[model samples]
Target: EAGVAQSPRYKIIEKRQSVAFWCNPISGHATLYWYQQILGQGPKLLIQFQNNGVVDDSQLPKDRFSAERLKGVDSTLKIQPAKLEDSAVYLCASSLDRIDEQFFGPGTRLTVL
Candidate 1:
């Protein structure tokens, strides 16, 4: 089975600039998630989608962060007008179900200058 895939592995942007990351989950997976992992900290759930509908996005920062999973397949995360504190690893993960084990992508590391 194909594993989760992410791109641009790393990024550097000035504070207040927008940045985006992409992800592709495993085939046939029904659940997708985006997480933010700051240095020296565990990953924090940012958003979750079951198929094409959002299951949870309570942790997402509505003022600056947004995400979407279209066609219930690939997904994208965008941080607009980025902040210096937003520097961290943006991880994309997928699971067969909400309670199942998740497979994670390599993640995109974003740095704000």
Candidate 2:
């Protein structure tokens, strides 16, 4: 495939609500990542997964955000009790390995009231 895949291209929720986004990586890829991109700011890595294991989540808000990549292919990211600050684009990216370049999916735009 040419790139990664993501679902529910857009979502709108009020503060204190919850939302989930999904992603599917290119075949043969082994690394997946989730990023949050706020308007006027660069995308920030939220989580990284290698196969079915977690690699990094240091920048993720543990109290509100959760993510998992199952079977090393599909991934999901969730946010609970969303806040206004959570309004941003959720991007999914995948690569063959940590050192390889990544191919990103069209992002999921989230609007939190």
> In terms of TM-score, how similar is model 1 to the real structure?
0.97
Stretches > 4 Å off in candidate 2: none
lDDT of 1 by residue, 1-113 (tens): 88899998999999999999999999988999999999999999999999999999999999999899889999999999899999999999999988999999999999999
TM per model? 0.97, 0.97
lDDT of 2 by residue, 1-109 (tens): 4678899999999999999999998998899999999999999999999999999999999999999887889999999989999999999999999889989999999
lDDT scores of the candidates, listed in order:
0.96, 0.94
Residue 95 in model 2: shift from native, Å?
Answer: 0.2
